[model samples]
Target: MFEPHGPKRLSDIVTGDETWFLFFIIPPKRLNRMWVDGQGDRHVVLRPGFQSRKTMFTVFFNYSGPLVVDILPQDTTMTATYYVQSVLSQVKSVINEQRQKVSTSRTLYLHDIAGPHKARATTQSLWELGIQVLPHPAYSPRLGTM
Candidate 1:
């Protein structure tokens, strides 16, 4: 018996995130949904009393699990130059080592429309690697499934 690749794994659907340790808590929209029959009480998210420091890291993973985690140097800005010069290399290594081998298969890169991710140099870097970019909408959290 053989298993045909269906939706595929991270090769078909993948997510990468560059997060800073900002302590802001955003309540999900579901919190606003209230049953008017008095069956539920209003939910609230309290703001933190003290501001918290932040740390930044870039990570890539898919339905199966995590693939890469690259912590950025403090105060480092992610520009097209920096991304192509640094981030792309790490991602390439992950894809090279962890990606499933299938002939004539397509790899769709589904990163969000972040400034660095969309820069021309970054796009060119991906192009050189023969990875196709997935069209992404800005501010669309639904597309970010990680």
Candidate 2:
């Protein structure tokens, strides 16, 4: 389902046209933590804890009714190049089919992040599909997969 940032127009959510959206959820485990000992007479130490482990997922929020693809990896290993390539192929096929159905153009908004797979083939494939990749700024959490 779609929701506008400022206003909720019925037409926005139920556009009745083919709109392809790629939803990516990347849960990055905060790599590591470091600490320094302060000069104190037997001081107690404290450190912040990370609550969740790193995981990535993708969802196709097809705006042409309830079309969803819950495709995800079964393994819990680190992200690999093959996995990204597979996802790219799947997404490209979906977009092409969706565009054909409603007789209209398509748009894509990719979340900005750096990784071996994301930086490689995924970017090039989207561009070949005439998809617009969103620009990402350095050290910016505000514009992220929330």
Candidate 3:
């Protein structure tokens, strides 16, 4: 469908996703070096057994570059309501402001089949914003078996 438009079609496509950001990262042993008087002064670095503190961030980008980056609010999970009201809304405004030349109605959105991305609220919101969602194929393990 986009063969005629080529690069222009690619430029109109926007993709978004969420990822966790660790509050603390353990440095590699090579980078954890320190000056010591002797071998006795060396200490063992114990890796944490428990999960570290982390925050989720939603990022939206197009062919040009990033359009929006939003941190999830503290103590809240990413739900359909939040996806529509927070993430998508911010992306909409940023696209309008930074990419004024691109028509919002022709903008194609791409994202994985996450629960929030497939939710009714998110679909309605995208429709209201005049952004078209590109259909993502669902992975089927059964098909691979054959």
Candidate 4:
């Protein structure tokens, strides 16, 4: 696991300004819970190829099951800048839409993510987006949980 220290303050989450970049991963089990059924009740179903999902640009597309993807990077890539750009763009869009639904400001606070590439690229990109990046320790689970 590419774990990094967690955030310490509300600003660390960046959501209050209506901008928060909290990264999490959901395996197939949790993915199964969000699926809508024909009857409109959510149910968990066992899918054969759910465990063999593919990771691309932080997206875990499991065809046999739900389509939820883990936004955390599982490994460092050669072209980290591009990867970060793609992930952040998608994340920012979703966040903006959600904030708009609640009529909130789009100013975000991006707590530093744990992965090496995430640390480097996300920080730079978020700064450009006017989100404050909280200071974090090197290897503390407390930061991640917050």
The Cα local distance difference test for each model comes to 0.71, 0.45, 0.85, 0.45
Model 1, span 98-130: residue lDDT tens: 655742135677898889998889888888887
- Judge candidate 4 against the unseen true structure and give its global Cα lDDT, from 0 to 1: 0.45
Give each model a TM-score: 0.62, 0.42, 0.73, 0.37
- Which TM-score value belongs to model 1? 0.62
Instruction: Report the lDDT tens digits of candidate 4 across residue range 31-114.
Output: 565656688866545564533333333431212332223344446342547545655565566555545653223343433344
Best model per TM-score: 3
Number of clashes found in candidate 4: 6
Compose the digit string of candidate 2's lDDT tens values, residues 25-93: 443444333355686454342323424333345544445553334334445432435445655556556
Error of 1 at 104 (Å): 9.6
Once model 2 is optimally superposed onto the true structure by TM-score, how far is the C-alpha of residue 13 displaced, in angstroms? 12
Q: What is candidate 3's lDDT per residue for 62-134, written digit by digit as tens?
A: 8888899999988999999999988888888888887788668878899999999999999999999888899
Candidates arranged by lDDT, highest first:
3, 1, 2, 4
- For model 4, the superposed segments whose C-alpha errors exceed 4 Å read 1-79, 101-121, 138-146
Candidate 4 C-alpha error for residue 67, in Å: 13
